[model samples]
Target: MTARAFPCALGAVLLTLALAGPGRAQTAGPSPTPDHMPKPGMSAPEMADRAAGRFPQPVRVGDLPGRFLLQPEESQPVLGRVTGLVRRDDGGADAIVRLDGVLGLTRLGLQPLAWSGVGARLVAVPVEAVALLGEYVALMGMTPERLRALPTFAPGSATAIPPGETLRIGIVRPFH
Candidate 1:
């Protein structure tokens, strides 16, 4: 496929995966090997926490950019791409996500038709609400409509988080 078509194809595949539902079998091949198991010293609860992306770890602010923002749910899932980070006066961080319409089609380089009355907007999502699940950042209990309704993020008015700062973030380890 051409470079332009690749993004559309990828979006379609992701939409398909989202529609497949979490209960559906993701792979037809045999189960993964034991190499995907948790760490040797990790307790059962720790392993469970890691699987849920609740195990917090100190991570640099610079590493957060470019991660895809995902709302993982059984229903329609919302997707966005992180553009930057904002530092709040409370010493917390927020992720700037580019959301277009309900599904964030703008992130795929497609604009919603004028008749649809949808447009792209940047929203600041509290880092506390984020879960680092593998390479994707998961936001639980969020919907596209709710995300779209959030106040738009203004970089000029917000304090930007420096790349060197460290923040404690929850991470999901597929293989710990």
Candidate 2:
């Protein structure tokens, strides 16, 4: 087609689409399945709530290990690395995170005591308290002080895993 005719044809198509309105334009495709359809009489928020309930992407315990634990709000977001997953008698799990002592010391505004290596310690963080964002496990609403206050997690000890509890996955260290 000629350049002048091309512009005129594009303008006519655009005008047709503009007159169709959003709802009319979107309704051209096949109807959504019942499971995908929004329930009648539901408000926007209600529909959202219903939709959220249908799909729950649970983070598996096996997948927790070796992933970086992030506290995004803090200046140093990379708080630690997940060492393992501890399973409780109640069927719940805790993420064993070996926190970076240097970051902790800096967060608390204290200098490191030793120059050789920062004294990294393990802490058990409830899996429920964390959300998996891509490759990172994000722990929200937890401060450095709060994290420090948590009792250290000692693996292979009676106190670490009560009689019935077990360590489903243990320290996943990267080979140098």
Candidate 3:
């Protein structure tokens, strides 16, 4: 794939990560482990907070093992929920999800995440029911069958997918 085939929007997601906010105060969160378990069917945001140790249950993103999830738009679960729908472009139907109802990305702290000069890079993670788009990716729509097929591993290990390491769960770019 000549880098261009990947999509401009997608390139932007990576740039945002490289520029992730210094992070608030760097709370003394739980250290990663190798025996973390799944959330037993929790929302992506819920899972993230749990992993962050904000909840009494304290869910660790690293505890998720090899799961497919991005950082939550908002740390505090509010009155809004995430929705996914399909749009027909030309003769093709594309899957789309708004990153937090439009302004979610800004809330996620991706400021000045301008596109990198431009290039192609391969991103890999072990998880199922993942729909990869140009700039962002989604995981809430996954089904049991798909979830079972994903690769889950020990938590706290480098093999684990770091929280906020994955972002743009809501699509915030034009698919061109």
Question: Among these predicted structures, which one has the highest TM-score?
Answer: 1
Query: lDDT scores for all predictions?
Result: 0.66, 0.57, 0.32
Better of 2 and 3 by TM-score: 2
Decide which is better by lDDT, 1 or 3: 1
* Model 2 lDDT at residue 137: 66
Name the better of 1 and 3 by TM-score: 1
After superposition, candidate 1 runs with Cα above 4 Å error = 1-53, 74-78, 102-105, 108-117, 141-144, 173-176
Candidate 3 to truth, TM? 0.18
Winning candidate number (lDDT)? 1
Query: TM-score ranking from best to worst?
Result: 1, 2, 3
Residue-by-residue lDDT tens digits, candidate 1, 73-151: 4342546778888887776677898766554556567865333326667788777656687777776323445655568
Candidate 3 lDDT (Cα, 0 to 1): 0.32
TM-scores, in order shown? 0.58, 0.47, 0.18
Give the count of colliding residue pairs in each prediction.
0, 0, 7
lDDT of 2 by residue, 1-176 (tens): 99889999999999999998776346677865433222334443453354344333644555557888765442436878888777655655667887767546744656544442376678887554455556776654244456656787888632233334433221111111
Local error of candidate 1 at 69, Å? Answer: 0.9
The better-scoring model by lDDT among 2 and 3 is: 2
Candidate 2 TM-score over all chains jointly: 0.47
Write one digit per residue (lDDT tens) for candidate 3, span 95-116. 2222222233434655523233
